[model samples]
Target: MSDQTLPKTPRDDDSVLAAEYVLGVLGAEERIALQARIDRDPDFARHVEAWENHLAGLNTAFDEVEPPAHLKDALERRLFTNIDSAPQAGLARIWNSVRFWRAGAFAATAALALLAIVTLREPPSPPATGETLLASLVTEQGNTRFVVLYDSSAQTLRASLVEGDTPAASDYELWFVPAASGGAPISLGLIGGEGEKAPHVPANLQGDFTDGATIAISLEPAGGSATGSPTGPVVAAAPVKKI
Candidate 1:
């Protein structure tokens, strides 16, 4: 896209630029660039907030309808069919999807409102060791399945499933892989299909959060890995990055 097509220059005269942003019309690159300005400019942030508040009213205009909690299986069968996960669908790819952006202004406003509601319900995480780090547990298909956030400020580790369906007869186990050349996987505990979890970081394991730490997820038995070590197929793993 042309650089001029994006709202790089946010000004009072171009206040509608905030509206376009709130409507999710900007591409990922454009969004990131505009976000940088929003972070540094207090007035611009307020301008964006005003747009969000104005757009949020659209959510109330229509009757609130909750989507079925477990629609992954059905949705995939219908949409994906013979396609194997439909490529990587990375942020950039999704941003460029015509069907996605074609949802237009009202649909985008509703989505933003829904996100706001979800964010409001998120409980605050306990402070960790003052340094923050995170790892995205991704599948071999290049899809991010879960995100593990290490809250050094709260001395806690939180994991949230970003994609994939919860197993009907099994559980997803979290594992920590040390940065050493040949480190064995250590079981952190089981995580749910959706939502966030603050798994118990054993006192012994607490000190093991190294700069090169990696997090892994495996499909395990109902409760968790029967053995202390991972005993199931490891589906995803990735090194943690500093926030």
Candidate 2:
């Protein structure tokens, strides 16, 4: 084909063009044209130098890891044996010929037939049964307030505390006080200042602890309540339903 009949180079805005081109991110025709210019002209090398400098900072953050022993061996084997220019040229010539394209169409048809048979023979799984709701407690400041999720019918509560956000100076304690009786509050467990925990509510007290019972968080000295009632001011309080 004549030079006038060949495809024209695409135009990019000059400011970002050189950066994008040197990053090996240009479309194929732009890459060919830029590479041709770099080969023939010395002045265009300055643009490439600027791109190299721009990308140098990015390399500092990358962590280098050694390749696996098997990968290195396989790469070395392929480097010496698999990548001959002669085979590549022969394959390209065959691909451009009519017979190779006809064979490719036949292979595609065979692949489609195998896929159809496999899909038809395979059976779909039955849907999973017995669904349950996920419950969580959170504070006004976007902090998670730890509490137990109770199976009220079974009168059982599984409790835990949120880690990291709790105060280090005092231990976070869980309290279960009957809302109706104003009765002596029972201590559930000592929750940590760090993370999630699972403590079971007392089996005997579980009968009296309704979902509407008041659950309170209070600061306690190292272990928990020495007395039968909370000594500190309520830092966090909610009904059992809050979880």
Candidate 3:
């Protein structure tokens, strides 16, 4: 039997394009191309259907509002009154045009999609009661390495490695710097290699874990920083914010 390979499925980029099409945000040429694909390609048609279904729920949140009393009159004047010379043919032609309905649907769908995106992007509400502080530590290259959370009640600092490449033969030392400009960086402790760690926050330093404080991780020798102060290069740092 002759060896043959099936076509690869469309990537995430295609899904995004399909979503844009269903949202009516694609430009004229792009929309035309996608519409052609939807008509001929079953996979592309499914992608469009999926996006439509996913976004359909958002429509329920929008309550219908009645248009202004003069709006209908204005539309009639603008579209029909201008065709006084050939009133019958012109009015019928404009009324039968698919472009008019398509434009209205496009505008409505685009507005709904925009609202949904803005709503989704909003940050979640903070907890009701907590002396919790959180920070997202990232390297100089802007790559997130860890998510750090400090709980004042428990006097504990939790560090979760999200994404990063650890240096071989070196350890990561945690440090806390107070918000004050003259305050020095105090070493918290050496972070473990495991993906999750909850190190006890020193009682004396617990008071310093306030908002605007800075938490950092420095790459040090296996034994950790030699001089109490950070002697090695700082790998990631983030400012603590109260929740």
Candidate 4:
């Protein structure tokens, strides 16, 4: 597939596959498929290059130390003693005996490769700096009907309709009421019926979304409140608080 088909963010599977391909741990068939993809997909190729660049620095971190001469002799003795004792008729079985050692070595190499990849990958970005404001708009009976989150970084107001029952032929209009008494409630926007709705905060009214600002939802005629002000009864109201 082309780069446009790839996910916007690097996925975990893609990241692992890129690391494995860079480390030469993939089997013949898997390696072929990944290489083909890299040739056709620029994004995958970039990911592979990034992984290689990230892991290349680890090669100079430590000097290799040679094992003692007797250690190799002892290991060979342990590994081949059984093979040497086996019947001549079982010569074909020697390959089976060596498979475990090969597999063990491969596993160790793969593990080290994985550790290096994970250690060298870039760290996650930190969360946005400003405090997020939250509000739980509730009915007069004190039952929460909607949850609102104001993200100052994105300058958006997100409202989630927690209580599912939205009146047919009517719209839910959201309003922002400043903390100062006597300030008129400002029209924010209309929220969807059953799911979450994120509306961009008006650039002119961004300053109205401060702590202690109240959010209220009103049921209005279909299409929204007509007079630019809430014309229906306020169904739910809650004060904004920093979260």
Q: Which residue pairs collide, candidate 4? A: none
Q: Which digits, one per residue and each the tens of the lDDT, describe model 4 over residues 1-243?
A: 475754555576688789999989979999999999999999889889999998999889779899899999886444322121211231111121333333423433444456547746858547667757766654544332565678887776766556444555667788876677887777777765223322446788788677666667777786777797878777666666665
Q: Which residue runs does candidate 4 get wrong by more than 4 Å?
A: 1-127, 142-144, 193-198
Highest lDDT among the candidates is held by which one?
4
Q: What lDDT would candidate 1 get against the real structure?
A: 0.61
Cα TM-score of candidate 1: 0.45
Candidate 3 lDDT by residue in tens digits, 1-243: 748964455667677778999999879998898889998988878888999999999999999899999999886444322121211221111121333324433333444456557857988656545577766655544332555667887676766545444455556677886677888788777665333322446678776678767677777786677788888766666566664
Candidate 2 positional error at 113, Å: 50
Best by TM-score: 3
Order by TM-score, highest first: 3, 1, 4, 2
Better of 1 and 2 by lDDT: 1
Order of candidate numbers by lDDT, starting with the best: 4, 3, 1, 2
Give stretches of model 3 more than 4 Å off. 1-16, 20-129, 193-198
Residue-wise C-alpha lDDT for candidate 1, range 111-187, written one tens digit per residue = 44565578568885565447766655545444435656667657666666556554555677888877677878777
TM-score, every prediction: 0.45, 0.37, 0.49, 0.44
Question: At residue 177, what lDDT does model 3 achieve?
Answer: 67
* TM-score of candidate 2 to 2 decimals: 0.37
lDDT score for residue 110 of model 4 = 49
